[model samples]
Target: MTILAIGAAGIAAVLLAVWLKGVRAEYAVYLVMAAEILFMLSAAGRLEVILDAMERMRGYIRVDSAYLGTLLKMIGITYVAEFASGICRDAGYGALGNQIQILGKLSVLGVSMPVFLALFETLERFMK
Candidate 1:
């Protein structure tokens, strides 16, 4: 999993460099999405491991469940945004892709409100 992730990052970095060197933005986006897909697929079969790692990190970081939940929500938001944006781009509506991205961000923020409120309530109780 780590290896796949590292390779994906390396490829993305190279693709980004290619774009910076004037290699066409469209190709760069394709390459980035391909890399993301590859890494995501590699991680797909290891969800248990991923969750365990997240839990271990939570323990090490001394973070509450709210923080972990928010992190997960952000991750989900990123995945959905990328998917919708890609679809819109494939359909030849770059403008729609941008709109989808904005909508995704808003939806994630809205969904996270409950968790944030719960966290705030916990903190308030602690303060009292």
Candidate 2:
């Protein structure tokens, strides 16, 4: 959380500086690039903690196994899609952003295919 806080503070400082100096919003894209770099550098370490938190939440709530994996996958898909989309947008490539979004959606569906199949089988069994 400290890294996140620091990054947020740095972004706020950059925006404030830009505003004070009459920098164009386009110039602020550099700050977004810097933040994306920081996220890329820090994400591996952060992912472990995030998974741990998810595990803890699952245990604390005793969530149904069928729901838990789906939720986790949804969260992962959202985060990855948002991160890719944001970076592409920040780089001023709307076409690339749209492509990234399409890829994200396709990748997510690919990853979720097995889970969906399992759920379908389970439903089939229940109906029989």
Candidate 3:
């Protein structure tokens, strides 16, 4: 979907949720969750295009496929963590959301460790 359509949908969802919050607060939360699912589904449809572009860039750049894969994984982790954390916070679980963000950061760090090691090794070689 185009950004304009997505923005419209998001605004509509928020407005409806706000109205619903006055009547049934729990339903408002459900509405938000449903909207999030819809938005995520819409975004998933574009992932292939993004992956194809990344692949093209990799072809031109001579970078390791493993590193590209790691970068993609890190991006995925960050998005999923942020998505989950936002939902948690919306549901009134701020602490859980914070923990999710922390875990996401740590997971990204862990996933990129190999790249860090390679960089350090390169630096060490230059130092010799």
Q: Considering every candidate listed, which one attains the maximal lDDT?
A: 3
Listed per candidate, the RMSD to the true structure in angstroms reads: 5.9, 4.7, 1.0
User: How accurate locally is residue 13 in candidate 3, as Cα lDDT from 0 to 100?
Assistant: 90
Please report how far candidate 1 places residue 17 from its true position, in Å.
18
Give a tens-digit lDDT track for model 1, residues 58-95.
87887878767777777778776877787567546899
CA lDDT, candidate 1, residue 57: 95
Off-target runs (Cα >4 Å) in candidate 3 are none
Q: Give candidate 2's TM-score.
A: 0.62
lDDT per residue (tens digit) for residues 68-87 in model 3 = 89989998999899999989
lDDT of 1 at 125: 100
Choose 2 or 3, whichever is better by lDDT. 3
With a 3 Å backbone cut-off (N, CA, C), the pairs that clash in candidate 2 are: none
Ranking by lDDT: 3, 1, 2
1 or 3: which has the higher TM-score?
Answer: 3
lDDT of 1: 0.75
* Superposed model 2: Cα runs more than 4 Å off: 2-28, 40-44, 53-78
What's the CA error at residue 97 for candidate 1, in Å? 1.1
Which candidate leads in TM-score? 3
